[model samples]
Target: MIDVLYFAWVRERIGIPRETVTSEAATVMDLVDELRAREERYALAFADLSSLRVALDQELTEFDTPLEGVREVAFFPPMTGG
Candidate 1:
């Protein structure tokens, strides 16, 4: 199982802060496809991948990044610098 965390509007849209997912996805994008197929809320939250940022094990990564042995994945909106 992989820990999936949603932050900011991602959490708001999905109505949850985090979840444990048992998946067969080999990449982050594949995992997204699974989630998007689960419900409308997930689809909406992940509709525009360009508007989102992802992290693998707390380190920023691309959606195509491999999920092998990954324990955590986080999704959030892009951060703004002040």
Candidate 2:
């Protein structure tokens, strides 16, 4: 099981902060496809991939990154240096 974490507007849209999911996805994008197929909220939250940033096991990474032994996945909007 992978711990999925949603932050910022992602949490607001999904109506939850985190969830533990059991998936057969090989990559982050594949995992996203699973989530996007779960419900409309997930679809909306992940609609625009370019607007989001992902982290694997707390280290920022790309969507195509493999999820072989990842324990955690975080999704959130890009950070602004203000």
Worst 10 residues of 1 by lDDT: 63-72
lDDT of 1 by residue, 9-78 (tens): 9999999999999999999999999999999999999999999999999999999999999999999999
Q: Provide TM-scores for the models.
A: 0.99, 0.99
Which regions of candidate 2 fall more than 4 Å away from where they truly are?
Answer: none
lDDT of 2 by residue, 33-80 (tens): 999999999999999999999999999999999999999999999999
- Predictions in order: lDDT: 0.99, 0.99
